[model samples]
Target: MNLIEHLKEDVRFEESLKACMNCGVCTAICPAAEFYDYDPRRICDLVQRGDEEEIEQVLRSDTIWYCGQCMSCKTRCPRGNVPGELISVLRKVSQELGLFRHSEKGRQQVLLMNSVHRNIMEIGYCVYPDRVDPDYHPEQGPIWRWYHEHIADIAPKLGANYHGAGPGALRDISEEDLQEVRKIFEVTGGTEFSEKVKKNS
Candidate 1:
């Protein structure tokens, strides 16, 4: 599809891309630009020019995935543009077109989808203590390991209901609520798209 056609598919993209005056403000304020070779200003420039080939290249490259989606660019842009939101639109387009598989970082979506998606679907929490294995996530630290081991003993002290019903952290999620979440996934096409991503990866 043409760049303009694609842009029209999502109104947010058109709204996100205000005329780039070649101002370096977006790149200057971009945290990803500092740490990585990612420059949202360059992306804006390319897309603003309606260069389909370059935009496709941007979609396939690691540059598009580097945005932290902090929307700091939105806050800093002189034209009221949102490079972070634009990056999000780019990411969705990349994933939908199966272009994300071209980058190593993008390929990691399989791992993220498997873990985070399943965590939300089954436990109703994206990052539950029981699911965080110390071997897999050493960054969680020794304290997390200790807490995981002594959760039963420590949870009561912290006023967390642990496995019981009702409010507070790690509380049991009802089957009814879980079914509702599943319904949302189904209605939003999230489940089908996620399955397609897994298969393509």
Candidate 2:
């Protein structure tokens, strides 16, 4: 069982596979699988068979970004395998590969990641990055004030607190880690600032 290097959490892919029932249900229910012809069943089967390349190919696919973390497939799986969780772990790995920032879907994930990083920098908890409605209203009294007040209402639905006025995000990350992330982002051209620049230019 070789360990895969990851950028964020240390996800043990092997541990998530103990309950693989080979029922083919995960492949059936995955939205990405349906839309992109991605087969989680095949990926899992190949990984179990010691075929790392096949699993790697699956990891490289853009199809992985569709998982919404609903856990619907996980609850219904007869094999006890949480394909959704596995997809999440794969998404983390995919982000490491810098594939996450390429498409619009991927960019959305990057925004979420940036939000969490900002939380780590400012407040310790990862708050949802306050999204603005289509109609820009100055009467809303600044974005922060609106987010601070109304964020609590959505907490119950999200299943997270995400509202505590904790310390703001860190202004500076460790130089070494920051450099590494930047280098990786630069290589993939995935940084939001980079994308914005590219589009404007």
Best by TM-score: 1
Model 2 lDDT per residue over 1-201, tens place:
132434124455645565565778877777767677567776556556655565565555666666666666776678777766777777666555555555455556646555555453343335434533324335656665666566667555665545343223322235565567666666764565444523422
Report every candidate's CA lDDT. Answer: 0.86, 0.57
TM-score for candidate 2, residues paired by index: 0.51
Model 2 alpha-carbon drift over 4 Å, by segment: 1-12, 19-21, 29-38, 97-108, 123-201
- lDDT score at residue 94, model 1, on the 0-100 scale: 81
